[model samples]
Target chain A: MSSNTDFVLSIEDLTVSFDGFKAVDKLNLYVDKNEIRVVIGPNGAGKTTVLDLICGKTRATSGSIKFKDLELTRMSEHQIVRAGVGRKFQNPSIYENLTVFENLEISYPKGRSVFGALAFKRTAEVVARVEEIAREIMLDEFLGTEAGLLSHGQKQWLEIGMLLIQDPELLMLDEPVAGMSARERELTGQLLRRICTNRSVLVIEHDMEFVKNIAHKVTVLHQGKILKEGSMEMVQSDPKVIEVYLGH
Target chain B: MQVAMNKLFGGREGLVGLAILAALIFIIMPLTFDIFRLNLVGKYLTYAFVAIGLVLCWGYGGILSLGQGMFFGLGGYCMAMFLKLESSSPESTKIQSTPGIPDFMDWNQLTALPWFWEPFHSLSFSLVAVIAVPCIFAFIISVAMFKRRVGGVYFAIITQAIALILTILIIGQQGYTGGINGITDLRTLKGWDIRTDEAKYVLYFLNGALLIGCILVGRLIITSKLGRLLLAMRDREDRVRFSGYDVSSFKVFVFCVGAMMSAIGGAMFTLQVGFMSPSFVGIVPSIEMVIFAAVGGRMSLIGAVYGALIVNFAKTFFSESFPALWLFLMGGLFIAVVMLFPNGLAGIYTSYIKPRIDAWIQGRRGGGNLTPTVPAEPQDPVSPRTAERTPASAASRSLAAGIQSEPSRS
Candidate 1:
């Protein structure tokens, strides 16, 4: 646990339930800065629920969640966002009717102002930042296109780019490559690699290969509790993990 | 010609098409139509101002306001009161002898002009009143309703009831409000003879200018971030609520803006028509304003202009020609248009024109090859570094079917 000193996020026995049904039960996890930690679970095993709790979507019932030593359990969703925690929902939650560039513009913290967004002069640096991000994601050609016209894979990329522009310290994504094509998924894997050098990323993915490709560490959840937590290869070899994946 | 036609009717070409059409109306209507028709068109343009406001409120804010006509009436009354006093004053020489006090005020008997009406005696006061009164009413109502999150049919019902009550109150206060007969016989505006043909054209041009201004402002706001937020609210309101925006504040701002625009239309209506009445403030007129925005294409600014003209034209034609079945015709028009063209006339042009032209151009270049339309993913790509491990683990992988086969071997 010596490496835990560098941990940016610490979740101590967090529990979240809908009505009486516990979704995340006494979940304990820690994510170090600049690390890609993957959370994998069965359909109802509460992998997404954990991300939801972190992002302030589903409030934790009893456990404390802290980011950068700030208690996140009591903060509003937007407050969490403003506190440098960004989230991308499983279903893309972008303004569909707006152009792709406009969608990115909204995610920029400065443009949220009523007067600033309208009358604020676009500086060269901001323009470069937007262009740089767009090019990195291979979206330069589609910058002017309406976001609604994007394919599922493109939307996932765009959502990720949006978070990047927000410049959040912690980025939580739920199933980022669920609907992406094989080629797009490979590109996305590289894109995520580049991002991990800067920000702490927590991705909730079901794709084991993608997880193995990107995840530095993996956590397994079964029936609302953590089944195992270790390196991807080690957890993949664990008998409990094998039983959850293969059954009987 | 084909390109021009597509540009004119294309859905997103709201600003361009509206500019061209408005210019044509301002120029052509005066030449082809007589003095009366020209004046009528002037009044219609004023009504279009109200439609623009309604477009901002209901189209963007998702508030189904059915009482814009009430704001129109408020502005009309403000202007009418000023004109009434100037024309009917004993010191005036318009009539051979003094008309004494206005008929409504004389009937009240104890009149030295109500304290509220005193400020409206000045042209400046009336002008400010036109903007202020409606804004105040909108602010009060919106604050109360939106703060409580009372929306949907209840919002519509409440506004409609306000219109009905205002009309009855105006009509019942015969001495003060001029009763059901309403105020008429206004002869001049700041000494310009309103009856003159030249004056009529002046009013028409003034209205045309206002229409352009309204369109430009609406266009600017719609393209802004606030507009995007408004549209997003329509799609996923709870998401917006959690996004840290005060949804009610935005709603209130839009409502006040819309109400002020409607009030300006009312002031213009009074100047052009030389009258104001309880009938204009009633539920039916309020409903007509909603219909004007709805039939034109609820979401498009140009559609509001088109709706104003088409619905008003239908009203004039059917009322004069058929009279008995005019209401039925309007209702039928509403049903037919809503069913056939959900996006209204603007929707019709876009769906039938722009895509075809795009397809035809693509076809000519490729010589009949079908072009594959790929949905481009949004420009922002999710960083793969952020991928969390699938908690499904080896033991749980067998239970999930659709996702289990993906990327596990990578």
Candidate 2:
């Protein structure tokens, strides 16, 4: 991680404590360009907290989170997003009050100021771009649908589509398919594969089969520390990794 | 026909609202109402300004500013200061010890105008100050509160506390703010006596036109992408923050804009009513203004106007004829509105009336392809005369209005 300039993100000794329960303790992680990295863990293992720290939603006690050359821990959430990092919450957090087209259109990387938004129009290009993303997320026919009316799985996909609209170099998603059907999960796996060709994805997922299908490298987190970091097959073979994650 | 309708109303129900407002302002009120009653309507319209502002702030931004009265009083006092100074010409105030100063100043043993009162001597400065002062005050409050991420009920309470502070400050400093009487004896604006009936009529018309302009500006904002973002932020603020937008900046911007709108109403109130008082600058009136917005349909600009007119009209009618029952009626109205009509008049109109009209229009168009958007459920029991508010009805109705009609072309 130190020598490789190809790395898009590097976290050095990152730690966060909530009432003395170290949620993410001295966590060291790295993701290279175009890499698809998945952090697998049981509940309260701080998989989500790590994403929160990287996205500037949660402050680190004392650590450094560097995205490319920019320091993320010091920046605000909006600033981190502008610096080419996008995050999706564990729950489907897309704007339910807006339509699918609007959800995607708002996430588009232009006209961000108050005055800009006042004059922002649904031009031919914007309409086309929104439509393209809607199709990619399998929500083409539902573009006119209010996002609140979408199925649980559909909303999950819409959030991913919203993040994709920005064309961010790095995307962080929490529980991308927690409530998704097997069919939806398969589609999401395919979507992840396509997206990771040009960008990086740092995901927190529990589905081992889904992880095996999408992750180029896997990191297993247990009790605020990394238990194993390797390929799916390599990590699955590790006794310590199996003991915590595959205990069920 | 569609283009004409859109041009006239901005949308379906908006056109209906615009038509009624135009008729009321231009034809009905001018013909039917006497100067006194017309002036009363003008006063009520002033409250409509604050109500409309509340629609944007509370309804869309999900920020309930319980102290909008602070901005309202700020604007009103700014105008009153100017008018009070103009009326206190040396000749008119010769009986007072301080001939050139306002009577209140003389009563409170003041010999010269206060430092803050000097700027109002210039009409241009007064006019600018009326809008600018409130906006600046609102801007400072918004930046301090929103930047720190303080919101929801906490913001509302702080605003209410601020209203209480301002009221006390104005009343305590009798020498400056005129105490309980406020900045009264406002007889003129640039030497034209506002007390005359002709002057009242002129001011009423001017007030109506300015209100229409404010409503149009509000319409422009709510229909813009910025408006949609406001709705989005209300529902999912973190999503908006993560979308690379400064959430606090947007909150501050809307807050200031709402303040400016309330300020305009305040100035207009001072002009038509011939006085400004601390009665309208405290917690009671501030919350009452919010109730007006809530009653009118928080989401609809047109509804806000109707809300102000109706609530105020009822207040005056009940207070004059039934006197003792007015307070009871007001309390009941607030309770009924909160419990039954969460969306207010506009919500009822959209839920019950708008759907029927849509059906009629579709019937005329040889309707065959109406697909049910929601999973088929029994319609709520609705009385035709009253507003029927189901939480989802407003959302679905607006959705149907925007998207359902356009999908066919694609």
- Candidate with maximal lDDT: 2
Fnat per candidate, as a fraction, reads 0.15, 0.59
The residue-by-residue lDDT of candidate 1 on A1-248, one tens digit each, is 12244678998888887898999888889998899999888888988888888877777899888898678899876678778888888988776665566667556666544554445334566667777788877787776655666678888888788788878888888899998888988999999999878889999998888999999899888988989999988997888889886243
Give the candidate number with the greatest TM-score: 2
Minimum summed lDDT over a 10-residue window in model 2 chain A is located at A1-10
The segments of candidate 2 whose C-alpha lies over 4 angstroms from its true place after superposition are: A1-4, B1-9, B322-324, B358-394, B398-410
Cα lDDT tens digits for candidate 2, B293-327:
99998887888899999999999888999998987
Residue-level lDDT tens digits of model 1 in B126-233: 888888988999899999998778887999999999999999999888878898988988888788788788988888888888887777777666555677667767
**Candidate 2 chain B worst ten-residue window by lDDT:** B376-385
Query: What's the residue-level lDDT of B110 in candidate 1?
Result: 38
DockQ of 1: 0.12
Shift of residue B112 alpha carbon in model 1, Å: 6.6
